[model samples]
Target: MEVVQVLCMKGGNGDTSYAQNSLLQKKVISLTKPITDEAISNLFCNNFPARLCIADLGCSSGPNTLFAVLEFVTTVDKVHKKMGHELPEIQVFLNDLPGNDFNTIFKSLPTFQKDLQKTMGAGAESCFVTGVPGSFYGRLFLGKSLHFVHSSYSLQWLSQVPRGLESNKGNIYMASSSPPSVLKAYYEQFQTDFSMFLRCRSEELLEGGSMVLTFLGRISEDPSSKECCYIWELLAVALNDMVAEGLVEEEKMDSFNIPQYTPSPAEVKCEVEKEGSFTINRLEASEVNWNAYHEEVFSRYQKIVADRMSREKTEFVNVTVSMTKRG
Candidate 1:
C-alpha cells in the first residue's frame, strides 16, 4: 500500500474518529513520559538554545498529539526555571503523513494555547506551534534544527508493505503461519526503513540532541511471536471469515497486508548500531494489558478481539528507546 497517500487516522471529533479512539495512544504517551522528560531536560541543560525547536514525529491528531508537545515544553520550562535561565522561544512541529488530520489539530490550537497559558503562565507566550505534513522516513526539517524529538506509538509502521510476500497469504502480518520468506521480508523492510529514519533525524538534529521513541515491540527473538503479531492475526481471522461469507473478496484479502512491523529490542539495537548516527542512551520494554472488554456494544470484529484478549489476557509489549546524536 502507498502509506503516505493512504495511511491516516480517522479524522474529526466523531465517535469513530481517531481523536476519540486514541485512549491507548494517550496511555502510551504517559507510559514514556519519564524518558521524554529526561531527554528534553538533558538537551536543555547541555546547551541552552534561546530558540528551542522540537518535533513530535508521527504526531497523529488529537489530545495525544499536543499532549507530547506539552510534556516536552513543561520539562524544559521546569529545568530552565530551576537553573534560573530565561525561557526559550519554543518552535513546535507536529509531523505525520500528508493525509493526517492536520485540520483537526489546527482547529484545536486555541484550546491548546489556552491550556499552555494556564499551565506555563507567562512562559507560554513564547511557544509557537505548527504542523509539518510528511513521512518522517525522509527529511522533514532543516539540517541541525531540532534539539529534542519525540515519537510515541509510531515507527512500528513501515514505509510500505514488504515486497515478495505473495506467499504470505491468509495472514495480514508476520504470523506464525507465515513462511520463512515472509518473515525475512518483514525484518529486512524494518531494517531499511528504521535506518533511513535515523539517518534523516540525525541530519535534522543538532549536535548532542536527543530523541525518545516508543512503539510496539516484542520481547522474543521470534519474528512471529504472538505478542507482536496476534492482533493482526486476529484481524486476519475476521477478514477470512468475511471472505468465507462472500462479504469480501478472497483475492483482495489475499493481496492485502498491514505495513507494520514490531521489532524486538535486539533487532532495534542492531539497526541503530548499523545506522551509526546515534548512540542508544537507554532501551526498555514494558507490557501493557489490553483495555477492558465490553461485549454488548462490540461488532463481530471487536467481539473477536475482545474474546481472544479476555481469554488470553494478552498484553502489548512497548519498547521505548532514548538516543542522542553524536557531535
Candidate 2:
C-alpha cells in the first residue's frame, strides 16, 4: 500500500474521529511524560538556546497532537524558572502524513496558545506553532535546526508494505501462521526504514539535542507474539469471515497487509546501534491495555475483538527510548 497517501488516522472531531478514539495514545503520552520532560530539560540546560526548535514527528491531528509539545514547553519553562534563567522562545512543528487533518489542529491553536500563555506568561508570545505535512522516514527539518525531537506512538508504520508478501497470504501482518520468509521481509523493512529515520533526525538535530520516541513493540523475540500481532490477527480473522460470506473479495484480502511493525526492544536497540547516530540514554518497556475499536469495520470484527479482550490480556507492548545526538 501507498502508506504516505493512505496511512492517516481518521480526521475531524466527530464520534468516530481519531480525536475521540485516541485515549490510548493520550494514555501513552501521560505514561511517558517523565521521559519527555527529562529530555527537554536536559536539552535546555545544555546550551540554553535563545530559540528552542521542537518538532513532534508523525503528530497526527487530535487532542493528543499538541499534548506532548505543550508538556515540553511547560517543562522547559519550569526548569528555567527554577534555575533563574530566561525562558527560550519555543518553535513547535507538528508533522504527519499529508492526508492528516491539519485543519483541526490549526483551529485548536487559539486554545493551545492561550494555555501556553498561562504557563509561560510573557514568554508565551515568543512560542510559535506550525504544521509540517510529510513522512518522518525522511528529512523534515533544516540541518542542525532542532534542539529537541519527540515522536510518540508512531514510527512503527513502515513507509510501505514490504515486498515478497505473496507468501504472507490470509494474514494482514506478521502472524503466527506467516512463513519464515515473510518474517524476514518485515524485519529487513523495519531495519531499513528505522535506520533512515535515525539518519534524518541526526542531520536535523544539533549535536547535543535529545529525542524521546515511543511506539508499539513486542516483549518476545518472536515477531508473531500475541502482544504485537494478535490485534491484526483478529483483524485478519474478521476480514476472512467477510470473504467467506462473499461480502469482500478473497484476492483483495489476501493481498492486503498492514504497513506497520511492532519491533521488540532488542530489535529496536539493534537498529539504533546499527544506525550509529545517537547514544541511548534510557530504554524502557511497558504494557497498556488495548482500548481502540473502529466503528467503520463491521460488528463482526468488534465482536471478535471483544471476545479476545474478555478472554485474554489484549495489551500493546510499548517501548520508550530517550537518546541524544552524538557529537
Q: Which stretches of candidate 2 lie over 4 Å from their true place?
A: 294-296
Query: Candidate 1, which segments miss by more than 4 Å at Cα?
Result: 292-298
lDDT of 2 at 50: 83
> Per-residue CA lDDT of candidate 2, range 72-146, in tens?
888888998988888878899999999999999999999988988888788788889999999999999999999
State residue 174's C-alpha deviation in candidate 2, in Å: 0.8
> 106-168 in candidate 1: lDDT tens per residue?
998899889899889999999999999999999999999998898888899999989999999
Question: Weakest 10 consecutive residues, lDDT, candidate 1?
Answer: 291-300
Query: Model 2: which residue pairs collide?
Result: none
lDDT of 1 at 129: 93
Q: Could you say which candidate leads in TM-score?
A: 2
Span of 10 residues, lowest total lDDT, candidate 2: 291-300
